[model samples]
Target: MRRICVFTGGRADYGPLLPVLRAVQKDVALELRLLVTGGHLVGQQGMTTERISLDGFRVDEQVENVLASDTPVGVAKSLALGIAGYAEALNRIDPDLLLVLGDRYEALGVAITAALRLLPIAHISGGELTYGATDDSVRHAITKLAALHFTSTEEFRSRVIQLGEDPERVFNVGAPGLDNIRTMAFLSQHDTSKLVGVTLKTPVITVTYHPATADPQGSGRGLRGLLAALDRFPDVTIIFTGTNIDQHSLSITKDIEEYVRRREASTRLVSSLGQAGYLSLLKISSAVVGNSSSGIYEAPAVGTPTVNIGSRQDGRPRAKSVIDCGEDEAEIAAAIDAALRISRDDLPGLSDTPYGDGYAADRIVHILKTVNLKPLSCKKFFDLPDSYFYMCSNQRN
Candidate 1:
């Protein structure tokens, strides 16, 4: 049996990986192991570690690395702690392959340790660019470190190849989040309204704004602009998910709480809704308004409109379903106004997601089961001579 280890650290990363994790569990040829860490341990967002237990998955390891402090220094120190914890746990479990998703520093830490141990690494969602939060750099770095790549879209697959990875090693499977959409039968409009404690008969908006805490001034400016816009639309009820645990996230969290407390408003702000509840919210929400990639990638699948504000998702591929706006109050308000006007009949037809079709788990499992792990290696760009460029078919030199 091929032993495979998958790591999940935060709610944002976990939302995309849960479906594949389940598939890994059911694969007969695979000994699926789970490594849990980061935000899941913190009680802020329901402590997903407990949720994992409730979901019935046996946890193989829990590495505590997140510091209580929220600063760049804290993030740097946390990376070191994560690498140490993962290296030790990996030595004990010693899976043949290590699987990781997305661009969190914690995921990068584990991937680096796996590479050092000469274990084959299967990385998902690599090569996609997210210009916000330094996640773009971390994602590309993981792409170079991993031996096998499972990209969510064709664009991402081509990017991995351009980065010198062998084309045969990369597979473009649809976004795994879409799998949850395809498989889970969401509640009808009536049930969803009851779940969120709001009436869905009117316009419903879903918002997920994570701060770019890496910046010194703090990243709540965009959230402030969005809040100002939301204030203008008192007719619509909004659902707000908490920000990821980055350097300034705590401050942003406090700001949001204070804003909600000060205003006796019609909106409901939540710390989190699990994968199921969040997806159900997507199904019923008239438009998803936020800086999250979920608005860019997952909303279209259910014909949900998206108003994506700010630079967080600057370089990623998006569908016509999205309206890109800036952090300015007026621009954000205009985008929200446009989004509210988008009727259900006018919602973008479910486009073939650039990310994938919801079947990444099977492809990932197949590669892990069959690939040779002995010669674990990364891609290196060749430096060809200028004189030989004419003779070479490739575009080097």
Candidate 2:
């Protein structure tokens, strides 16, 4: 049995990995070494660690951090702590392969440590571009470090090969988030409202905005623009999910609390919603207003219109239901206006979401269970000279 260790540090990554993790757990040939770290371990997002155990998966290891800082300096120190923590954990678990998802610094920390230990890594969602955050760089860096790639789209697959990885190693499976959409049981609007402890509002909006790590002062400015835009829809019940913990997290969290407090009657700020609740809320929401990839990837599956603000998702593929706007008061407000006009029923047929069709997890599990293990731990880039294939064909002729 191959000891496969999956590392997930945030809800954003963990929720999507659930399907694949479950598949791995049931596979007779695999030993699922589930490594929990970062945001999933912290109570910042509503005690996800407890939820993980409740979900019935046995946790293999819990990596801790000594630093609680959110500044760049503090984050750097955290990375140092993560490297130390992960290295020690690996020493104990000693898995044959490491699985990492997304581009968080915590994910990067594990990938770096795994690389040092000569452990083969299977990276998901690599080669996608999100120009707004330093995630673009981190994603690419992980792509280079990983031995196997499970990309969400064909476009990303080609880009990964262009980065000099063997094309055979890159598999274009659809986005794993689509699997939750395909399978999860969602609460009805009334039940959802009751579960959330709020009465149902006709035109509800769900907003999730993370810090634009590219710009130092951009988080506050962009958030203010979002708040000002939402002011126009005073009657709308806006459900806001907390931002990812990053260098600018403290400021974003503070501002969101202030925004909710000021608009207390109409706004509710939730830290984490398990996959079912979150997706169900999106299903009934009039618009998902934010720059998060969820707006680009998952909102379309639920037939919700998305008012995507600013450059956070600049180069990523988006469905037609997604309305792009700048972080200006007028632009955001206008986009929200257009979003409100979008008929929910018409959304399913309108845009073609390039992400996936909800079967990514099976493909990921198949690869993990079947792929040969030993040679993958040590890899070499097959750098072929330009026109070498053509020349070889001519010589053969």
Candidate 3:
């Protein structure tokens, strides 16, 4: 049996990785090794490793790397700590292959460690662009490091090849996160309200706004503006899922707590919704109000309209279900009002999601089961003409 190792740093990665990880575990030909780290160990972010055990996946290893300082210094220290921890873990586990998702800093550090260890890495959701954060660059970097690539869209697959990965090694298997929504049973309206501890109001909008991280004003000021706009809708029951761990992540979380306290009955603030609950929340929401990729990738598939704020999701494709706007209160409020008008309950005719058809996990699982890992270790840079530069003397004069 091939030993397949999966690394999950926190809520975002684990939620999407869950279905795929389970598929690997069940396959008779493969063994699953789950290494949990980063935000799973952090207290304020709900220490979501508990969610992992609750969901029934056995974690094989744990590497604690998240730090308390929310400044640039803290971020750097976290990365250094993650690299050291990952290197130590990789040596101890010595898996045949490493599987990582998305473009987070944790994935970047781990990918480098695996590459040096001569372990073939398979990367999912590669070749996507979101210029607002440093993550954009990190995603492309992982593509170059990985031996195999699984992309959400065909366009993204092309971008991966453009980065010089072999086309035969790349697969356009769509987004695995969609697999959960296609398979999981969600809570009904009454159950959802009971689980969240409030009677969700009509025109329920689930809000999760993260900072641009690289933005000049930081996430706090812009998120505060979003809250101000949300305050305008006193009657709307708004569920604010907290911000990620970034420079101003805490500031935004604190502000949400204060705002939710003042509007107790009308608002709810929770740190991590654990995948199933989050998808169920989207199922009942009138509109998803946030800059999260969930608004772009998963919301449209569930037939929920999204009011996307700011340039965080600047370059990604959106379905007909999304409405883009600035961070200003007036603009955000107008967009929310427009989103509330979407009448289609589940998946609009000609849906807005360009991600996938919800069978990504099955496809990815099949590839993992059969793909040859020996040759994958010897990778070649398949450079495209567009990616090369002509030195002044190399050009015909």
| Top candidate when judged by TM-score against the true structure | 2
Q: Which ten residues in a row have the lowest lDDT in candidate 2?
A: 344-353
lDDT of 1 by residue, 333-396 (tens): 9999988888778664455456666676777777778887776654455344465456555655
TM-score of 2: 0.95
Task: Enumerate residue pairs that collide in model 1.
Answer: 152-355, 174-356, 174-357, 175-356
Candidates 1 and 3, the one with greater TM-score: 3
| Reference-based TM-score, model 1 | 0.92
Give the candidate number with the greatest lDDT. 2
Tens digits of lDDT, candidate 3, 1-397: 8999999988878888888988998899888888888888888778898899998888888998888877778977998899999999988888989999998888998999999888999999999988777789989998989999999999999889878899999999989988888888988888888777789878798998886876737345557668888877878998988677876677777778898899888788877878888888998999999889999888888888899888888889889888999878898889988888878754572245788888888898899879999988888998666424554336755
For model 2, the superposed segments whose C-alpha errors exceed 4 Å read 349-351, 388-397
* Model 2: pairs clashing at backbone N, Cα or C within 3 Å: none
Give candidate 3's total backbone clashes. Answer: 2
lDDT against the true structure, each candidate: 0.80, 0.86, 0.85
Runs of candidate 3 with Cα error greater than 4 angstroms are 218-221, 345-351, 385-397
Better of 1 and 2 by lDDT: 2
Write the number of the candidate with greater lDDT, choosing between 1 and 3. 3
TM-score of each predicted structure versus truth: 0.92, 0.95, 0.94
Provide the lowest-lDDT 10-residue window in model 3. Answer: 384-393
